[model samples]
Target: MHLENLITQKVKEAVEAIYDISLQSVELQPTRKEFEGDITVVVFPMLKLLKGNPAAIGNAVGEYLEREVKEVVAFNTIKGFLNLVISDTYYLNFFNGIRTDQSYGYVSGGQNEAIMVEYSSPNTNKPLHLGHIRNNLLGYSVAEILKAAGKKVYKTQIINDRGIHICKSMLAWKRFGKGETPESSGLKGDKLVGNYYVAFDRAYKDEMLELKSRGMSEEEAAREAPILKEAQELLRRWEAADPQVVALWNMMNGWVYDGFETTYKNLGVDFDRLYYESNTYLLGKDVVAEGLEKGIFYKKEDGSVWIDLTDEGLDEKIVLRSDGTAVYMTQDIGTAIQRVKDYPDITGMVYTVGNEQDYHFKVLFLILKKLGYSWAENLYHLSYGMVDLPSGKMKSREGTVVDADDLMEEMSETAGSIAAELGKLEGYTEAEKKELYHMIGMGALKYYILKVDPKKRILFNPEESVDFQGNTGPFIQYTYARIQSILRKADFDFNTNVLAEEIEGLQDKEKQLLKDLEAFPQLIQAAAAQYSPALIANYTYDLVKDFNSFYQQVPILAEPDTRLRNFRTQLSKKVGEVIASAVGLLGIQVPERM
Candidate 1:
């Protein structure tokens, strides 16, 4: 049992024996660093039964603990807090048990309901950008974390493959291109398609300006733009399954899909299953009709179906349009039901969308519950804030968004420059150096984004994130590499099976390091419970900080005492293993040597 648990149990027994009161539970907190203790038992909560001065009660409990519990060697009462100093043997025992177990913090996955995590649901018209990066990283990391916490997880994404936006790109390419293809242009399919998306926006604006010049109002001109009319016509034809239109839609979507695959691979995110809007767009239409027949939904005079959510504090939301066409909400509802049908074991789903859709998800989940799905209550919106650069917000249609590929390339370049200035890469081949630079860059990007609360907007700065100081990814990576170097130089046979016993006079630094290491398993559980990678990220930073302190104060290889040296080396190796595992949970790689 953990020290706190043991103490809480013993303290309960003590209260029953002394005050003749059966206390069910006790409040415990980490002792203040300024104080001399490992855990503190609060005395204020006991007044309900004991009815005595808080400090006196604290002293009595402290005396009882020191006398009865062998691990509790000393105690000090600060106001109502009773701080109890634990013996080094307890920490030593924990380190010895977990030292060789590289998978110390992770639990095995078995006999648990699988969870579906949906992220990176990008439109087919354009390439992924900065916002998509954040979504992918958060979703990927959360899936990995849930897996580590012993849950079966399925990572997936819905491809928005059909819409007016997609048609805009298709129409633009058809209008301006003389049979250009990705192979002919030597451009990524997604990028090529994205160029047309931008072109469509530009041409549409010019057409609007011309209409306004002919005495049309701004709104009238926008509504009657000839290019938009063409795009809408293309969408209608594609939906009607016209042979030529469907073929064009399939070909262009194929190009975008190919491009999207490359980006996902480069960003190191993957999906177990893929859902496309083309197939699922009409799914919820029938459900909406069923709702109307059942009076779960109301139909307007124009034949639109909507749910009145004003009573639920949200405005009315349309599920089906006036022309009997499915809206985005309709497709979303259908897609959600389709997932459960696809994976019968998925007990819950986590939608990794932006905070802008917070109300949308709330309404969706409520509607699903009203429709009487048991799993509706299991829905969660992993709502994250936007990722903004110092320059400003991005607009995809204007060709002003921060492309994911460009940002990744820039990160590697930044890492390369910083590494060269520090002279960190020596006697490395060109290929090896290039790979290291990418690893460092990706690590920097992922860590900087994951370390912050998902709800708080980030003002991302590449240079700051790549720095080798503070709570950055490279810093933790460097420390892990440093420990690996120590392990490589150690000549002793520090097999974990025959590790050191409770040595005489263990240093405070070493004990603290052990205490920190013991918290890893608990930290993983807490991070999973909160669905926040920030918890794991910051916990790792603290572990690295503690190890650094231990490294600086204690002599490992140079220690003449063989037993102590073995213990320290084993400790360092375990710390490195944990650091690698923790970062891996964030989908990050750590180099063995730096």
Candidate 2:
């Protein structure tokens, strides 16, 4: 058990024995740095029972602990705070127990109910962009963190594959080009399809302008545009499952899917299962009928289905249109139910979408609960704010968005330039240097994004994120590399097991390092509870700071005492192992040498 648990149990017994009173709870906090103690007990809470001088009560508790508890070696009381000093042997024992366990902080598997995390739900009309990057990174990191915290997790996404927006790209590709393919044009399939999506917007705008010039109102011109009319017709045909239209739809969607696979690979995110709107759009219709029969929904004269949520503080939401076409809400309801049917063990789901759809998820969850799904109570919306570049917000239709692939390439180039200026890659082959640059660049990007609170907006700057100092990824990476260098230079075998019996005369820096290391397992559990990777990110920075302080103020390799040198070396190795494990939870890699 940890020192605090032992102290808590002892304090309860001490109070009962000395004061003839039973205390129900004990409060413990980390001792202040100005005080010479490892743990502090608050004496004020026992005031109600004892009804005596606080200092006297603290003194009695301290005497009781020093006599009864082996962990408590010495104690001092300042007003209501009682600080107790622990023995060096206690810390030494703790370190020796965990030194050789590689998976010290992580739990292998959990017995809790499974959770499904949905992220990167991209539209097939365009390639992934900056906003999608934040979604993917947050979703993937949260899943990994949850797994580390001993929760069963499945990563997934719902692809928006069928709609009029998709048809717009298909029509543009058919009309504007004689014949073009990703293979023939020497471009990624998503980019080639995305170019046509932008072209369709341009053509549609010109058509609206011509109609307005002929004295039509702006709204009329927009509604009467021939290009838009054709796109709408294509959607109707697609809904009807016309052979020719379906063939073209499948062909274009196939290209987009292929391109998306490459981007997802580069971004280092994956899904256990995929859901498509094309397959799920018709899912809620039968459920809607069932609800209507059960008086949960109402139908208009025009033949649309809607739920009245006025009592619930939300406006009436339409699930199906007058023409019997399913809306986004209808498909979403179906998809959620379908997932439950697929994985009966899933107790909850996390939808990682932008903040713009916050209301949508709230409504979706409420409807599910009304439909009598008990698991709906556990659903959560991982809503996040939009990401903005220095230039401004991005518009995909105008081709002004920062493409994911291009942004990654730019980050790599920035890392290369900075590394070259610092001249840090001497004695490395060209291929090794190139790989290292990519690793550093990607690490910087992931850390910079994941370190921010998900609810807050970000003004992402490539130059600012790639810095090798301060609270950035490359800085921590460099520290790990420095530790590796220390290990490599040691002539003695640092891998030898450290015995608690041989360790003695612990320094203040070493004690602080051990305390910081002791908090890792609890930190992972807390991070998972908050669903925030920022907790893990900042915790890592703090651990690195502690290790750096210990490295500078204490002697390791050059120590005259053999036992002291061996123990310090083992401590350094354990710290580096934790650094690697922590960064791995964020989907980042650390280098052995910088």
Can you give the TM-score per candidate against the true fold? 0.95, 0.93
Per residue, candidate 2 scores C-alpha lDDT tens digits across 1-594 of 767778999999999999889999999988999998989999999998888888889999999999998878999999999999988888888898899999998988776778899999999988999999999999999999989998889899999998998999999999986689999999898888899999999999999999999999999999999999999999999989999999999988899999999989887889999998888888888888888898888999999999988899998999889988788888888888899899888988989999999989988988888899999998999889888889999888898989999998898899989989999899989999988988898899999999999999999999888899889998989999999999998898766666767765689999988987888888899888888999999989988998898898898899888888888988998899999999898988999999
Report lDDT (CA) for all predictions: 0.90, 0.90
lDDT of 1 by residue, 440-543 (tens): 99999999999999999999999999999999999998999899999889876987453335388669888878877888888898888778999999988998
Number of backbone collisions per candidate: 0, 0
Top-TM-score structure, candidate number: 1
Please give the lDDT score for candidate 1. 0.90
* Model 2 misplacement above 4 A: 3-29, 32-35, 40-67, 75-84, 299-303, 310-313
